[model samples]
Target: MTLLTYLVPVVALLAQVAALPATSSAIHPRAPLAGQFAGDIGACPPLPMRTTVPTSVKDLRPDDFKAVMAIGDSITAAFAAEGMKLNPVENILENRGISFTMGGDKGAVTVANMLKRFSPKIVGASTGDRIVSLCSGRLCGIGGYFPQDRFNAALSGAKVENLDRELNYLIKTVKEDKTINYQKDWKFMSILIGANDMCDVCDGTNLDGDTYERLIRAAFEKVRINLPNTVINVMTIFKVSEIWPLTKNELQCKIKRALGLKALCGCAFVDGDTASGVAKRKVMDDYAAIWNQRLLKVVTEYRGKYDNFAVILDPAGGNTPLTQFDPSFVSNIDCFHPSERAHKYMARNLWNNLFLDSTNKAQKWPKDLDNTIYCPTATDRIQVA
Candidate 1:
C-alpha cells in the first residue's frame, strides 16, 4: 500500500466522533469549573474558561498592571519576545507601528495582546523604563524547535518541568522590586505550556499522564501561593497531531520531512509506510486527545480550588478530530507554530470569553475577524530591530 493508505482509519475514527450526537449538560460558553469534563476518546467537550481580574470589570490599562507574566515553551514565547526572537513573547497589546521584541515583528498578538484593544501602555524588560517590568514580564516560553528543546533544563528553553522554578524566580524578583504594590496593582498570567510535553511523547521522550498532571498541579499551586490574587488564563495546547494531518497536503512540508528539515515529522508519522508506523501515528494522535482532556480536567479541578484560572480551548475552533484549522491559522515560516492571524483569533476570542458569560453563538467569543483593530497579515506588520 502507498503511504497515503493509512488515512482511511483516521477518517473513519473521525466520523465516529462527529456523527455521534452532542450530549446535554449545563453548557456554558465556558468550562465546567466543577465536575468532570465528560471526555472520552470520541466525546471530548469544549475547553474551560475562567477570568478573575479582581478589578471589577474596570478598564485595565497597561499601567494598571502591577505585573503580568507567562510560563511555557515557544508557543507561550510567541507573546514574550526579547530582541533575540528566542527570549520570551507573552503578548503586549500595543498598536505602535512596530512590535519591538522577539515574537512580534508580527505583533504581540497574544490573549494578553487583547489589552492593546482597551488602550494600555504594556511594558517589559526591553523597554529600559523603570515601569517596564512592572507592567509585564514574560519570564518563560523561550524558543527552540519542538523535541530539540522539549526537555531542556536551562532557563533558555523552558519546559513543563521548569515552569514552577520560573514562577518562583518571577515571584522572588517581583517581590524584591519595591516598584510593585500588589494591593492596588493587579497581576495577569498566561500559561500555554505542554506542547513540548506532547512533542516529547511524539519524539520518544517520556510523558507519564499522572506525572504530567502532578507537574501542572505543582506549577499552578505555586502560582496561587506566591501570586495569590493573580488572574490566570491558561490556553490549551493545540492539537499538534492535527498539524500533521493537515500538513500532509503541503508539498514543501512533505519534501522537507523526507529531506530531514522537520522534527514534527516523527511526531506525525513513524519510520516507514509499514502498518506499524501508521499504528504508531494513531497512538500519537490519541495521545494528543487524551492529554487535551487531561488538561481540561486539571484546570477544572484547580479552578474549583483557586478560582483564578481559565483554559483557552482552540478558540479558533476546528480543533477537534471532526474539525481542522484553516491553513492560514499556522505560520508560513514553519507549518508548526500559530500564524499571526491565529494569534489575533485567540486574542479576540479569549477576550470575549472573559468579557462575556453566555454560551449563545453571538455571545460566545466573536468568531468574526476584525482586521481594523490590528493587521493580521505578516507582510503588513513593520519589523523593529
Candidate 2:
C-alpha cells in the first residue's frame, strides 16, 4: 500500500477524534461563587458624595474618564474567549465584546463594562466580533480594520515590538473620532503584553530584559508626547512557564498539543521534562521576572514627569505565580488562553486595582471565581495621589 493510502485513514481517525464533543461541565464551567456580582451595571453602588470634576490627571476619578482605550495582544483581543464550544472555528473567534480589559458588551463583567457604571458617557470600549482566519502565523487578521475594534488597538499575537503600530493607530483613531474631544476628554488606557515575547524565548527570539524595557519605555514616551489627559494602566506580564504543570496532564490539552493546535508558546508548551525542556523553562522564568522589574522601572521613570499622563503598574498576574490559580481558569480550546470565566475575574481584578494604591493592589488570583468587585467611593481617585 502507498504511504498516502495509509495516511488517509489515519487523518480520518484523527478528525473523528477531534470532532468528539467535550463535556460542558469539564470544558465550560459557569457556576458562580457566593461573592460574585450578577454581571449587572445596576449592581454597582453610586458614588458616596456629589461628583466633583477634577482638572488635573492626579485628581481624576473613575467617573472622570470620557473615553477608554487598550493596547495589547490576544488576551485584550479576547481570542476564543467563549471557551470551547461545538464549532472549532468559533473557538478561535475574537469575542472582543467580552474581553476582560476592553470589551464593552452589554451584561458582560468586563473592565469597560464596569467603567460604564461609573461614567455612562465612556466610549471606545470594543464591541462585537473580529473573526480570525486560521493560518501558520501566531496572530491572525489585520489590526484595527474592524469597526468592532473601536478604541481597542490590540491585535492578536501583538508583542512589545508591535506597540508602535498599535499606539500610532490609537492616536490617529482618537484624533479622528468625532465624539471625543481629543485634547480635553479624559482617557483611560490599559496595556497588557509581553507574554508572546516570553513564550518565544525558547525559540531563540531576541527579546531579553533590556529590549523589553526599551520597547515599553518608547511606547510610554509616545503616549506621553501624543496622548494627553490619559491614564495608562500597565499590567505586568504573568509567568507563563508556571502554567504547564497544571494543564499538561489533561487529555484534551495533550491531544491538542499532539495535533499541533496548541503550539503558540514554545517555552511554555513545548518539551516536557527533558533536560532541554527544563533549561528552556528556567530561561522563560528568568526573563519573566526581569521583564516585570523593567516594567516597574519604566513606570517609576514616567511617574510625576507628565502632568497630563500617568502610568500605573497593575500587579495582577505578575505579582502572584500562575501555579496559584486553578487550572480551569485556562481556556479549553488551547489550554493557554484565559477562559471567559477568567476574563470576568480579571475584569474585577483590574477594576479593583484602579481604586487601590500600587502597594495595596491584590497580588494573588482570587480563589473563588466570583470575587467581589471593588466599588470606588467619592474620595477614591483612579490614579491615587
Candidate 3:
C-alpha cells in the first residue's frame, strides 16, 4: 500500500509535466534571483541595487564599457597553449562572433579568463590590451554563454598587493590608447583575490583579518580615486575549505601531482580529509570566511560612498551554504582555479547583478521560463518580449 501510494503521486507528476505545452517561449514568471549565476539570463533576476555600475540595460550599445578589466592571480592570467603559439580559446571566441581580441601572450584557458565569459552580447573591449603580460599558464571554459565579455587583466601569483601594482599598468594602457575620456566613460572592473593569503601558508606571511581587510579596502579606495566613473564589482573570495573537500580525494589531484603540476593556488596541497590537512583547511576556511565578511562590510560602506560599487556575496563563502558547486567547476589541471564554465557562472552572477533591475523593468520572455526550466527543450524555442 505504501509503495503504491508513493508511486501514484510520482506518476501523476510525470504525466503532468509531459502534458504541458511544448514551448520555450511560454515560461511562467517567478520572482527574480538576487543577482546569481544559476539560471538563464532570460530568467531575469533582481538587480544588485540602484547604485550599480552599468549605465542601463537598454543602453544596448554593441560596446559598453570604455574598458572591461580583470585582476587577480592565475585565475585571471592568460597563458599560451603552446607558450608562443596562437590560443585556440581566443580564436574560438572570435569565430563565434564575440567581439574580443587577445593583446598580450595567449592564455591557457582563454574562455574563462576575461570579459568574454558571460557578458552581454552587446559588450565591447576598450583600447585595453587582451592578455595581461604577467600571466604565463593555461588556466581554465564556456557553453550556454552569451557573447560580449570582460577582458583579462589578471596576472598569475597575484596577491592583493600585486593587484595594487597592476592597477597602474591597466589604467595607463587604457588611457594611452585614447579610446575614451577617463573621467566620463565607464570602465568595468572585477576583483577576485586573497586565496594565496589563506591557502598558500607556505609563504609564512599569515596576515591577521585586520591587515588583510585593510589591503583590500585600500585597493578599492584607490581604484575609485584613480578611475573615475569606474564600476567596481567585488566577488567575495572563494572558500578554500569547499575546494579541499572536492578535489582532495579525487583522482584528478593525484594525476596533477604525478605529472609534476601545481594548482594555480595550490589548493590540492591542503587536504582536509587527513588530520593535519584538516587543521590547515579549517584555518584557511576561517580566513576565507573572515575575508568574505570583511568584503561585504566594506562593500556596504563603499556602495554608500561611491555610488558605483557593488558586492556579490559568493554563495560559496560561508558554511554549508546554498550555492553548492561541483568539482567540475574547478580546472582538472590543477583543480584550484575555476574552470571555463565556472567563469561563465561568474560572469552570469555579475551580469545578473548589474542588469537584473533594468531587466525587471523590461518585458518577460518565455512566458514560463522559470517554471519550465526543467521541461523538455524540443517543444519550446520561442522568445517572448
Which numbered prediction scores highest in TM-score against the true structure? 2
Per-residue lDDT, model 1, residue 332, is 44
Q: Candidate 2: lDDT over CA atoms? A: 0.73
User: What digit string (tens of lDDT, one per residue) describes model 3 on residues 1-385?
Assistant: 1111222332332232211232343222342432222233233332222233345322321133445665665454422211111332231111111111222222211212233332333122322223323322121111111222224445545566566666766666556655557666656666777766665653355667787778888877777777776656556666655665666567856555444333333432633356766666667677777777787677667533444433323332233331255666565534555554444334433332333332241222121212122111212111111
lDDT of 2 by residue, 237-297 (tens): 8888877877888898888767664456777777877787788888988888889998988
Candidate 3 weakest lDDT stretch, 10 residues:
376-385
Query: Model 3: residues >4 Å from true position, as ranges?
Result: 1-64, 78-151, 258-272, 307-324, 356-385
Q: Once model 1 is optimally superposed onto the true structure by TM-score, how far is the C-alpha of residue 66 displaced, in angstroms?
A: 3.8
> What would the per-residue lDDT of candidate 1 be over residues 1-385, giving only the tens digit for each residue?
1112222332332233201222433333353233222212112222222254344313332323445555654444342222112212212211111111112122344444334323244322211111011111233432212221111112323456767766765666556556665444566666666555554464566566777678887877776676655555555555565666666667655554554434543555434446765665666666665656666677666443433333323322324331245556555434555555555545544443443222321222233333212212211111100
Which residue pairs in candidate 2 have backbone atoms (N, alpha carbon, C) closer than 3 angstroms, thus clashing?
none
Error of 1 at 29 (Å): 9.8
Error of 3 at 324 (Å): 4.3
The CA lDDT at 206 in model 3 is 64
Instruction: Tell me the number of clashing residue pairs for each predicted model.
Output: 11, 0, 24
Ranking by lDDT: 2, 3, 1
